[model samples]
Target: MNIWTFDQEKDLNTTGAGLIAALLQSKPKAVLGLATGSSPVGIYNELIDMYRRGLVSFANASSFNLDEYVGLPVDHSESYRSFMNEKLFKHVDIKLENTHVPDGNAPDPDAECAHYEQLVNDHGPVDIQLLGIGHNGHIGFNEPGANLTGGTHVVDLKEETLKANARFFPSFDDVPKQAMTMGVASILKAKQILLVARGEDKAEIIRTALRGPITTECPASLLQCHPNVIVLLDRGAGRFM
Candidate 1:
């Protein structure tokens, strides 16, 4: 695990975007595992700029997003699918057919989870897996628990998790109580992992996730199990470290 702290937000985003650009340049067909959240929005913007500059092209690349809200339609503005399309994919040259987001509305989400895991196994060991930590140390909506799932699956959102995400919806009542997320075992299969975080609000959890005990209670701490993990943090987020 390699950790880095940056003073400027742009520097952090540019550095992350550069890493992804380098991977795409070396392997045009690189499989990218993506995440959505305020933490990654800047990085995605930097990638969009790289695409416009012709410094990077995702033409042959494939992408799998980290998670999605269970009840949100694909077209919903807050859906991970919509977030990706609006934030990065629509502005880049990537083939839409190659991008995959878990079908939140599938009749049987457990089946969808099984199918998603299979799809990832067939096309992945993602070359680069990007992640963002939750206030409760969740990753991909894999909330804290006594036990954690090992493949893509559905999760009943924790009360805190629901409250955290309610900001994106019109009201607390509008927030979905469930989500579909890549599991800890699934995320560890990535060839490389890029974990990003910002703001003082994330400080304590960041310290616990990256430097404390590896446990199911702090799913992000499980990143310690991966052989290759790069963490990018802003001053506030890395304050404890």
Candidate 2:
């Protein structure tokens, strides 16, 4: 694993953007596994700038998102599908057909999870995966010690995750208790992983996941086993590390 710490969020975003640009230059049809939440907002913004400048094009690229809240409608303002469309897909040339996010409202939720994994298997081992560490070291809603399913599946959100994510909704009651997420094994199977974090709130978990022992106690610790992971952090998030 490689680590890069920047003085501010802008610098962090720039560094990540440059990395993605280089990857695109080398592999135009890269399979990109994406994540949402505030940590990746800057990266998406930088990608938009690259698209405008002709430094990169996502025309041939395929993308898969990390997770989605299970009960939310696709059009829900807070849904991951809506978040990605607004933040990244709408700004780039990525074909909507090439982009995949778990269907939160699938009537056959179990079938949806299996099919999502099958889709990734057919189109992946992802060329690059963008990830964000939850305040408690959860990754893709796979909270600590949930048996570590090796494929995409539904997850019961931990109380800590619900509390943390409640900020995005109108009230704590608006937060969903369940989510569908790519599993740890699925994520680790990616060819490369770029883990991003910002803010003081993420400092401790970032420290634990990157510098502490690898354990299922912190799902992000699974990244420690991956050979090609780059952990990018703003000073605020990396302080403890």
Candidate 3:
């Protein structure tokens, strides 16, 4: 695991975007595993700026989002698909068909999971996978547990997760009770993993996930088993380090 601490927010965003831009530059057809939520918004914005300035191009790249809320419509404001399009994809020149976000509204979630896994197998190993850690140390929607799933699957969102996401909805009850997320094994398949975190709220979990024991109890800790992982943190989030 390689850890980076930045004093300013722009530096953190630029660092993450730079790594991705470098990947796209070296391999125009590189596949990117992306994440949604507040942590990655800044990085996505930076990449959009890079695209506008001609500093980088995503014309030939492909992307897959890590997770999506189960039962949400693709057009829903909070859906991962919408989040990606609004934050990054629409700004770049990448083909819309080349980007994939799991269908959260699929009638048979099990089937959707299998189909998504097969898709990953077809276009993977992902060149780089981006991630954001939850306050409870979850990655994607893989909450802390005794045994973790190893393939794409539907999961009951933990209370902490639901509460954390409440801010995105008008009320706590509006937050989805379930989610479809890539498994730890699926994520580790990536050739490279980039984990981004910011703010003091994430400090303890960041430290635990990075320096603490590698166990299923902290899902993000599983990244320690991967050969290549990069951790980018703003100073507030790196406080415990």
lDDT of all predictions: 0.96, 0.91, 0.94
Give stretches of model 2 more than 4 Å off.
none
Clashing pairs in 3: none
TM-score of 2: 0.98
Best candidate per lDDT, number?
Answer: 1
- Model 2 over residues 58-115: C-alpha lDDT tens digits? 9999999999999898999999999999999998999999999999999998899999
Runs with alpha carbons beyond 4 Å of true place in candidate 1: none
Query: On residues 40-155, what C-alpha lDDT tens digit does candidate 3 reach at each position?
Result: 99999999999999989898988998999999889999999999999888888989999999999999999999999999999999999999999999999999999999999999
Show how many residue pairs clash in every candidate, following the order shown.
Answer: 0, 0, 0
Q: For residues 1-241, could you state the per-residue lDDT of candidate 1 as single tens digits? A: 9999999999999999999999999999999999998999999999999999999999999999989889788899999999999999999999999999999999999999999999999999899999999999999999999999999999999999888888998999999999999999999999999999999999999999998999999999999999999999999999999
Q: At residue 184, what lDDT does model 2 achieve?
A: 92
Q: Give lDDT for model 2.
A: 0.91
The TM-score obtained by model 1 is 0.99
